[model samples]
Target: MKKLRKMFVLMGTVTLMVNFCSFNILAEDGIKQVSEVQTINPRSGNVYYKYKIINGKKYKRLWSADKNAWVDPYWTLA
Candidate 1:
């Protein structure tokens, strides 16, 4: 009766909160930013810069450089 109804409401609230938290975590895990220099080789060129991986897709992080840094162009894709 009243006690059973209260328990069900509490359970529903807990479930909703858990779902919201999990969704937020999943979103956060998909993409992230890095500050340190890492070797990157894309079809465009090779250079060292911070990079990020989002949803398993890689993207380059830009940095200023005067000289071209040598890197194996194949290491990134192959």
Candidate 2:
């Protein structure tokens, strides 16, 4: 009985570690997208835009070289 209980505990620990690692991997993808969006910059006379979706809504913002910031207050709906 003691051996059986130890086996179950080991299995549970392995399952939890696998789940935690997968969640971290998924979160890293989101962080990568945000970092990519932040790197966009307007060139010459053209305006550069980036979009992100959140909560089933699409939002967009443009880089402004004149003001050195994003044009929208909190990302307007695209």
Identify the leading candidate in terms of lDDT. 2
lDDT of 1 by residue, 4-29 (tens): 99999999999999999999999988
Off by over 4 Å in 1: 32-78
**Global lDDT for candidate 1?**
0.67
RMSD vs true structure, all candidates: 19.8, 19.5
Expressed as tens digits, the lDDT of each residue in 1-78 for candidate 2 is: 999999999999999999999999998877643334466665655457878999999989997766677866678899
Q: Which ranges of candidate 2 are over 4 A from the true structure? A: 32-78
Candidate 2 global CA lDDT score = 0.82
The estimated TM-scores of all candidates read: 0.40, 0.39
Worst lDDT run of 10 residues, candidate 2, spans: 31-40
